[model samples]
Target: MTDVIVGAALVRAGKLLAQQRAWPERHAGQWELPGGRVEPGESEEDALARECREELDVAVSVGGRVGADVPLGPAKVLRIYAAGLVSPGDEPRAVEHSAVRWLGLDDLDDLDWLPADRVLLPAVRTLLAGSFSSLSTAQDGL
Candidate 1:
């Protein structure tokens, strides 16, 4: 099976953005990170932005991959990104979600994340220790 690369964005400010799955979906009723399938010819950054807009109806500033659950060949790969809302009106619109909520990290395990994302839970916690995303070393000059 070809591994699908999906973007997983965790909105900060003491809460992780989660969305309830629509009925008949693979993970229906479960709360998962808001994102979508990466499109062809699109960079991960662009894909992340587009996915956020389509899934949550919000604009987000794409950040680094704080965590990634990439299985060996044929297994699915989920790239977890550290992103922030671009505006004050960043609340979810539920275009693709049944419901959305701001959840604390401690409540993460309570939600039913996809298998790959569940594996990345630990890494996500670690990244949360720092603020937002990391600045590129190359950008230290600026």
Candidate 2:
């Protein structure tokens, strides 16, 4: 069976949270979403929440799946899910990453993303676009 690695596409206030890798020389300095391998017997959502807490020092509320599964290698697959900070005002610090940034739509393509993460850009774009559209509609009504 293929191992599952979950990624959190955590968005807030029209921005998506991205983290820069700090190690594994080949991938260091490249950006990717916050997440890690799902432990055996743990649900994807649970693993995502745990990863967020461990990697970002913040709690996240996992939402729906964001994109299709991406192959990592012969034995591992990547899955991304929509998520948001449990406390909207909470700031995510780079606990294990080199740095963390909140990226706007225009900034997404500028970063050098890890190969697996690059595949999900379109889905992430749609997620952020939907967020902005909803915010715009709500503001218009107000």
Candidate 3:
């Protein structure tokens, strides 16, 4: 089985959490969904939760995956899952990066996103759209 790189498409109030890279000059300043590689003995969910805690210092609940698995290398693939903050009062920070930004669908295209992360933008857009698509039905007046 190939190793998987997991990411969290954490959206709240119509915005998705994006973490900016601060290391490895090559990728510095690029944004990516918060996550990392799944360890040998860890399940995808566990890995995501662990990554979030380690990288963002916040807990999250993983939901259905956002996009199809993307090839990272011959033996590794990148996968992302929809997620929400477990502690609503707690905000994610750039524990390992330079910054964290919450972006709405309209602003998605403007970021200098990490190569792998940019691939999931379409799916992320779809997810964010659906998240706040609720419309009230008031046929009979209140």
TM-score for all predictions?
0.79, 0.98, 0.92
The candidate maximizing TM-score is: 2
* TM-score for predicted model 3 compared with the true structure: 0.92
- RMSD to the true structure for each prediction, in A, is 5.3, 0.7, 2.7
- Predicted candidate 1 versus true structure: per-residue lDDT over 1-142, tens digit per residue: 4455656555656467777888666778877677655676877778888888888888888888867556735655667788888895657677887888777657778888766667777877676545333333335557
lDDT of 2 by residue, 12-65 (tens): 988999999999999999999999999999999999999999999999999999
RMSD of 1: 5.3
Question: How many clashes show up in model 2?
Answer: 0
Q: What is the descending TM-score order?
A: 2, 3, 1
Per-residue lDDT of model 3, residues 33-98, tens digit only:
999999999999999999999999999999888989989989999999999999888889889999
| lDDT: worst 10-residue window of model 1 | 129-138
Positional deviation of 129 in candidate 3, in angstroms? 0.2
Stretches off by above 4 angstroms in model 3 are 135-142
